[model samples]
Target chain A: MAMYVVGHKIPDSDSICGALAIAYLKNQIGEEAIPTRLGDVSPETQFILDKFGFTAPELKMSYAGEEVYIVDHTEKTQAPDDIDEATVVGVVDHHKLGDLTTSTPLECWIRPVGCSNTIVKMMYDFYNVDIPPAYAGIMMCAILSDTVIFKSPTCTTADIKCVEALAEIAGIEDYKALGMEMFKVKSAVQGTPTRDLVMRDFKDFDMHGNLVGIGQLEVIDLSVFDEIKADLAADIIKLKEEGKRHSVMLLLTDIMKEGSLMLIASDNETIIADAYGVTVENNEVWLDGVLSRKKQVVPPLQDGFANA
Target chain B: MAMYVVGHKIPDSDSICGALAIAYLKNQIGEEAIPTRLGDVSPETQFILDKFGFTAPELKMSYAGEEVYIVDHTEKTQAPDDIDEATVVGVVDHHKLGDLTTSTPLECWIRPVGCSNTIVKMMYDFYNVDIPPAYAGIMMCAILSDTVIFKSPTCTTADIKCVEALAEIAGIEDYKALGMEMFKVKSAVQGTPTRDLVMRDFKDFDMHGNLVGIGQLEVIDLSVFDEIKADLAADIIKLKEEGKRHSVMLLLTDIMKEGSLMLIASDNETIIADAYGVTVENNEVWLDGVLSRKKQVVPPLQDGFANA
Candidate 1:
């Protein structure tokens, strides 16, 4: 049976590159698998794909009645639209286990690392398959993006070790320069569409039957948020209305400052206020020392929804 | 910080032996960890411990405000009483992810292998730690018990490979003899108390807010169940009443016939009848080709409960 290897919706650099890397490794071990994407690639992911001389994976909106292997995520909502109908053969992820259930037992490799590519790199080593330099380059870029060049709090020693080893394999001598190049593309928000900006790295969650969506963008400066604050808030409202999410948030993460300015658009403003324990002023609030979305953004929203 | 390595409640041989083996490997790697059990040990696990010259781990009823690394199972109901209050450092398991949520990110190694001990055995190889003969013997017994001597449908190639390697390490030339030796101890029901017989290898699950408990025993002969059928039913009712379980079941698995005679005590008998499409005959029914509790028994029961 043909197997589709895909990442989560609103594909980030790590999910896109990690899916490709795992597909490559699986095919090397005599499996019939091909890389696919659940959503359009972000600019940073597109830039990395171009730099590594690889084409973007074909977009797969659904996998009904087919075999698929998920990478970078295990959440059913973030997976392909018809994930419940598909036969999930395997999963390689680096996130909290969401409400994804499989009818049959399958291989799953989940680790608490910074990037899903870190787990894929270990899989290559375990299978004794030599990773191609292009795959290594993209994998390295994914690690850099997900870990925010080792500045994110989720960065671990294993992530650092894998970054160094993968960098060596990719013949990357100046890791900082490569990371900055990727970040330059990530922060190029001038003239970008407001909807694209809000949907770049979006993730949807089901918190006690409430649909919550959070979008994040990391940049070296916070002035970009000041320039597009109103438009971003409008886009958030539009997205929330269209998707019927209980809350839609956009996190303007200042990587250099290790803080985020969160813009919220929801029917219930008290949920946001109670979530972060801060007044929602002008539909926005500054959150100091909020770097990791999985750790910082999601849990409190869940708690707030629970309380509400 | 002291790390208490623990297994799930209703500790089977795989869980009990896997916890001890992981604690041994962790301590060898310059970490302070001690194996602990959430519930009393079974006679089969006790037999393996005795054969390996090891003592049963101290009972750890709660892990309130402590650091812990869990093994064998990851379901919150199977975990310690105060798992939500504990800081989970890591997890090494082989079961489906349940409702166990950690406050912070932690290392989790979950695979699709049949036995948790198979994953622990791989860790020994990964860390380059030579397994002691005693640990190897116990690990072998764990694999044998969990996989039902490679008869259960959950048995994978990894489990078979680990069983063979562990058997070699334990210097056992005849794996069948060793497996039968273990099963003989498991099926010894004569003169045993009714509660002990049913509680030997029991597991409790919260199926959509319903407290469901299943107790299983693998026997070479079916006559043993005929002798204790009435008492087994009585004990199931008593345990369900005392434990406040919504439903309690006893699976008398005849390994020789590769089927199970299920005795169920529940407020709703139609759920079981609808789950397997078999009529409930005097509080029991014969289930042909039902070898795995996880793959066969639990999933259908869960579906039945959901429908109910």
Candidate 2:
């Protein structure tokens, strides 16, 4: 039987390339595994897949099965159906452990790295899976997207090493340039919907008595953002009410120039501080060189929340 | 031993409450598996989670592990570290199956229902998991979200049954109000960013000889979308050029009483017509409730292209 790999909803660079890596590894190890895209392919994702000659997987919803192979997420706030299963194949993750089961004899791999593609590079090293230059380029792209080239709050030493190796394989000197190019493609609106323009791939978090939601959007011509700024805020307000969270944060990362220009429309700025460590400049968040929320923002904020 | 339950990213009403049902079932079976959120949470998700008193899940990258479990999502992108040694426990899921394998004995329950939560409710039925009235409300919401209350392209017969049962249990008579409330909460984008007001999540599909990125944005106020309409075409052009794709198709889904308002600003109007059976009108797309690109639009366009 072939092993299948599915990425999350609205699969980002990490989820996409990393799934390819795992499937490649399975193929290397005599397992039939195919990489698939699980959600609607965003423009950003399409950029990389097409550039690297890979296709996105089909849409796949989450199960929360009895036996789950937790990837880069934690288990806190996880429902029973999130993972209710008898068999788990593997878990390649980069976030804090929410509530990993302590008793299972599972090969659990949770790293503080930025992207799972970093782990895939490790598997390439440990398992000796041959890395095609194109695939390597994809993995490197995933790394840069996840870690923002080690600029995120979630980056670890492992993430850096993975990028270095994948970069070597891809024969690229500047990952930042590549990443900038990738993000820049998403810049500005010619005629895209505001809903589509606003980043929707969000995850839920909580602060002190505050339910939080964060969305990362990348666009060029930051001026265009100012034009539709109110609409974005309106969307956030709707999100806040719909998510039933007290706060919603949307970080618009500009890889072509300075750090991200954050658009935070929340009832409390403290939650913004907790999530981004950046203050609002006229209702817009200005984070210092933070490209990857997981690497540069999530860990510190999560830790700060724990401490706070 | 505690059971492991994994759910989908954005942990919607379906996944969260469905996760609860499976967790309750496992508890009845003397196993404690927890449902985990897969990725970032959205505002709508937070709303659903809080409405039922479920905390948001910690963010994760992916879930790929042997002997692991999942609920809403089943296709593994990246495996959790080691799966060969880990004993497969049990599984409850509601997504189309993909690479799911275990070297050892594993019990994986996969369902092709519309929502994983529906599957969990099924387990609730069999295991006699005590359904809290609050949870019943959440499950009803999940069913509504997944089935679009019998309006979505992905809906199945089982989704209707699950929602019907949950509605009865939750003592909900007028789902229209609940749905309207939810829609109001999501569609009310009075303060969202211009970019966000247009499109948040999108995908790329082939239209004629060019690849187009299509995004759908939902909003309640027609006036809010007024100012940014012009810039949308320019932005889509910029994005297409940067991403090296041609023809970005955008649809501004007006979720209010106005029905759906579409905007197509691509050089490929004929392409859109080739894909979507309806031709473009006034450089904008006009569809009579054809939303599903996968099921409704793509197939016809594919046929058109083949015929062409």
Which 10-residue span in candidate 1 chain A carries the lowest summed lDDT? A96-105
Model 2, range B24-109, lDDT digits (tens) per residue?
56767787666555544555556777776777544443333423455554333322334233444555554333343332223344
Candidate 1 per-residue C-alpha lDDT over B1-308 given as tens digits, one digit per residue, 9 for 90 to 100: 77999988888998789889999999998888989998888878888999879999998888888989998766777888788668887788777566676545566677878888999998888779999988999999998998999999888999999989988888889987889888888888899888888988888887878998999989988898777889999989999999998899999999989999999999888988899999998999999988888888987887677667
Model 1's DockQ score: 0.35
On a 0 to 100 scale, what is the lDDT of residue A50 in model 2?
A: 94
lDDT of each: 0.86, 0.60
Error of 1 at A262 (Å): 2.6
Off by over 4 Å in 1: A207-210, A237-246, A266-283, A299-308, B206-211, B237-246, B266-274, B277-280, B303-308
* Fnat per predicted structure, each in turn: 0.22, 0.00
Candidate 1 Cα deviation (angstroms), residue B224: 2.0
Q: What is the DockQ of each candidate?
A: 0.35, 0.01
lDDT of 1 by residue, A164-254 (tens): 9988999999987999889988888989888888888999988778898999999989887677888898889999999998889999999
lDDT score, residue A168, model 1?
Answer: 92
